[model samples]
Target: MSSLILGIESSCDETGVALVRLPDGGAVPQLLSHALHSQIDMHRAYGGVVPELASRDHIRRVLPLTEHVLKESGTTLQDVDVVAFTRGPGLAGALLVGAGVACALGAALDRPVLGVHHLEGHLLSPFLSEDPPEFPFIALLVSGGHTQLMRVDGVGDYAILGETIDDAAGEAFDKSAKLMGLPYPGGPELSRLAEGGDPEAFKLPRPLLHSGDLDFSFAGLKTAVLTQAKKLGDDLEARKADLAASTQAAIVDVLVRKTLTALKDTGMRRVVVAGGVGANKLLRAQLNAACAKRQIRVHYPELHLCTDNGAMIAMAAAMRLQAGREQAEKTYAFDVKPRWPLDSLK
Candidate 1:
């Protein structure tokens, strides 16, 4: 018999739900339906996400989104055999909304429930793509709150090779963009502006590039952007595109070099890039070129899957369920880990 799983993700500003069907003895999983609600407009005025607002918005959207997924999948809630949700490493209030909804639904249905790690969901997202990487690959997770490299030996077996000591790569992009007067969630906006600008126009430091460790640091890079912006004076907007281009180039340079180094250090021929920054065109291009030169394979989630979404959460839950991973007990009530470490989970 086939098993259907309902997955909910509210790790950040996005509320996502996906229904995945696991077939009997199948090598690949099937994606039934998925829905995502972005809170970009809600948080745009504030220049970034506010946890309380994000949590409230999630509560309002999750159920409807779940309904949409079920309807689109042509499956009723009663047919769902398992419930999955993102448990931690995100906003405490946000995680609670997902956890509460998932647990409640699971209990009402008398089904098992699993709490997934947000980063793990990102790491496994590539598997949902057409060309999935083989086992024992390296993963570079670069998002708003994190930047890390890991060695994935198998399902649920993740080894942290290196990570950021300061602000994450995505944070750097957003911060730099803000310094250039870009709006909230400036990372993508910054990348767009970078298209017409000369990447070499500004000389920005690649923080910790020579640290000799896989660990990264972008706080200094952000400072460099700030300094440059201040020097540009009142006409900062006129040079905004160029500034964006230069900043992005600096960041991509460091990320590409470090990822290549990690691949070489671990002797892993396959690499998977995840998180919001994974969508950066420059980073993707550079990584592709670098990996091609070394005959190393690179994997990425579909563009839509690159960001925080429910499909990754659902897919990850399916894998854990198949592996017989422990389930959250009915009485097990927990909150989010605002600072959960991926290594700690491992």
Candidate 2:
């Protein structure tokens, strides 16, 4: 009999539900069905995600998305062997929506429930693809709220090598885009505008390039963009694309160099890039090139997978279930940890 897992993800503004069929003997898991509802448009006006709004929206969308996943997968609730949901490192209200729904469903079906770390979902996302990386690799997680270098020894073993002291890479991109007059969620938009502009047009500082540690800092670079924008005065709008391009180049340069350094320091040839900034074209291209040049391999989830989604949450849950990490209790009570730590798991 095949084990079907239903995964719920509402860590942020996206509500994702997915089903995965895990077979015996370590065969590759199959994606049965997945559904996602993005609250991007709803929060776009605010220039960034609003926590209260995000929580409210998750409550509205989680149930429908779960139903959609079941219908799309052609499976009934009884067929699901386990229910999994993102449990922490996210907005309290948002995490509760997923946890509440998943626990309720697990109780109704009399199945085991598991709470997965949001970043672990990201770390294991590459497994959803054709050729996944093996264990004991380096991971550079650069998202809107975090920037860290980690050593992944196994499914539940993670060691942090270094992290950011201030603003994350994604936050820097968004802030720089704001300075350049781009709309909210400005990271991607800023990259698009940069396509036609010259990366060498402006000289932006690459913060912490030679800090002699794995830690990163983009706060200074963001300020540099502000200085440049202010210097341009009334013509800032006209030179927006150029400014965007320069800012992106500086960011990518720092990320690539730092990641390569991590790889070299650890002697780990395999590196996986995760989180929102993982979708940046320049970063991908430059990192790919750098890895190739050093005969090192780098892996990334597909563009859609790079951002927050349900499939990864489900997949990671399946892995944990197979490993017999922990089983769910017969409790409908669930609470969210808004500031949970990944290292706290081990």
Candidate 3:
């Protein structure tokens, strides 16, 4: 058997391809090569991803990206033992592009295929880092569309601690940024602007900060940001940085506190953060500082892997196969799940 896993990810605005070599015997898999194409610039003018355009771009990017990954890995399609792709909780059209291509390739190569859950890929992404996390850690999954706390015991063993009831942490960031007239992908832009201003410059609500449970709600926070911007009125532009700082502070505060509450409740001493928002420096710094005070180890995906990427998908698949949590299928007929829950993989 080739023991090479090929992963494709087109769940949203990014197209990614990667190759991972599952180690002989029972060692962990190693990432070989991966390539990604971001559609952020393309969607900037529109303020968000357009589903049809994203699907078309995935078609144009996946194959060439796959070729690049194979070439960089010193391998070819013939060496692939399994093909994996993000199968859901995303735009249906975009999901189809990756699922269709992955299935077609699997059929052509006579290799089995596995449909990896998108969030599961994110949750397991830290394993690709140099300081990979051990099993049985608490996970905080914060991204553009989702915010969740999970207890991961093993490859397919996950228990969601709590999830967002309304707006997620990322959504809170983006919407707050939009109110400040930041760029389309507003979260990072807002975070950047926030650096120059005092986080206490404006008072923002930390929604659900004391709700007494892990459930998150950021919708009210976004409303507070909008109100603050309107109050600034003609001076909004000059004071935008302050607003950004305050917004980020509110979101980060809620996330950090809730995460700590989860840790306290579970009595676990280690936490792993994954997904796009995991790349935010403020969140990372706060989490690190907080965890340090409690002697809890905090792990994160490599900065590059913090976003949707091929390496995590491939690594997740390899781990699943290694643990016998799932079996690769030779069947080529496949479908995408635009709303699959991460814990459903169990």
The candidate scoring highest on lDDT is 3
RMSD of each: 1.3, 1.3, 0.8
Model 1 collision count? 0
True lDDT of residue 174, candidate 3: 92
lDDT of 3 by residue, 70-171 (tens): 999999999999999999889999999999999999999999999998899999899998999898999999998999999989999999999999998899
Which residue pairs collide in model 1, if any?
none
Expressed as tens digits, the lDDT of each residue in 178-246 for candidate 2 is 888899888989999999888998999998899998899999999999999999999888888899999
Overall local distance difference test of candidate 2: 0.88
* Candidate 3 ranges with C-alpha deviation above 4 Å: none
Q: What is the lDDT of candidate 1?
A: 0.89
Question: TM-score order of candidates, best first?
Answer: 3, 1, 2
Q: In model 2, where do residues sit more than 4 Å from their true spots?
A: none
lDDT for 122 (candidate 1):
94
| Angstrom error at residue 319, model 3 | 0.6
